[model samples]
Target: MDKTEILNNICYTKLVYDRINKKLKSNYSKTEIETLLFAILKETHEQDFQKIGKNFYVSNVRNNIKITINSNTYRIITVDRLIKTKK
Candidate 1:
């Protein structure tokens, strides 16, 4: 599929966008999210991902940025930040 088609196929909920904007303060635009999703799909092993349930997966894009998605639907459920503890 082309990049635009691939991007259109991936979905994100309103709550997910809100969290990314407000809580995470990432201000991630749709284009940025689309690029990240494309990267995840293209090279999943390169991204840090953990299976949380039968159909749910959480991927860490960066040290702090994380995204939870439904494997079955390919829908982004939430976005949040990982808290880092100082040694």
Candidate 2:
């Protein structure tokens, strides 16, 4: 019922983490992982980048950088907005 539980229950969360972890372990930087994760999230949900952003985070601003996944593009800012990415 908590935020953590909801995120865990979502298939995209697990897939996103797995893909992002693999990317991270394979020499990708934090920004690159963020970008990759964003793209994967969009692809997995079969949604546009804008919709994905609105559902996933409190803020809706697009990150300056973009990434491609399954031939679709997405924009991501950070891995953890509630903590590491808080401004």
Candidate 3:
């Protein structure tokens, strides 16, 4: 499926947007966030999924992109880029 279609399947809450803005300070628009999420989900098999708690998952997409999600609600809790570690 296309990125837009993939994004349409997921849900996002206001808290998610707040966290993204506060944590990343990128001022990313909703469309931008959706696009990024689409890219991440598209590579599902390659991404890392960790169970943080009941019905909650943290998905590490690639080396940088990461997102926390509530499986039951399908709500995105947060989205941010990982800091690069020095080798």
Candidate 4:
């Protein structure tokens, strides 16, 4: 699916919540995670959608983050922050 369709259909599942927390290594509540993620994605433009294999990687460059969603299910698989580098 495309970015708009995916975002519009974004869904949450109990198991996925655990995965997100583990991947992010944070203890954000479900509500907080959903709210924060949606806020970031809302600011993403069309160009932010990057499809590789079976998932779409929606990235927010300013936040240095990437959100992975299943192309078929539109369920969030995990959230990740880019590792900072020494400049």
lDDT of 2 at 45: 27
What TM-score goes with each of the models? 0.59, 0.27, 0.67, 0.84
Error at 73, model 3, angstroms? 1.1
Which portions of model 2 show Cα errors greater than 4 Å? 1-24, 46-87
Best by the TM-score measure: 4
Top lDDT prediction, candidate number: 4
lDDT (10s digit) by residue, model 2, range 1-87: 123332233333335544545533465655665555545443332232322423433222243222322212222223432223557
TM-score of 1: 0.59
Model 3 RMSD vs true structure: 4.3
What's model 2's overall lDDT?
Answer: 0.37
Candidate 4: RMSD to truth = 1.7
Candidate 3 on 40-69: residue-level lDDT in tens?
Answer: 765665325655564344455354667766
Worst lDDT 10-window in candidate 3: 1-10
Residues 1-87, candidate 1: write the lDDT tens digits.
133333356687766666667866667787786676567545544335655674344445454556666666667776667667689
Off-target runs (Cα >4 Å) in candidate 4 are 85-87
What's the residue-level lDDT of 26 in candidate 2?
A: 61
- Residue ranges of candidate 1 with Cα displaced over 4 Å: 1-9, 40-47, 59-61
Better of 1 and 3 by TM-score: 3
Instruction: State the lDDT of candidate 4 residue by residue for 1-87, as single tens digits.
Output: 466687699888898788878887888888988998888888888698888999888888887889998888888888898777789
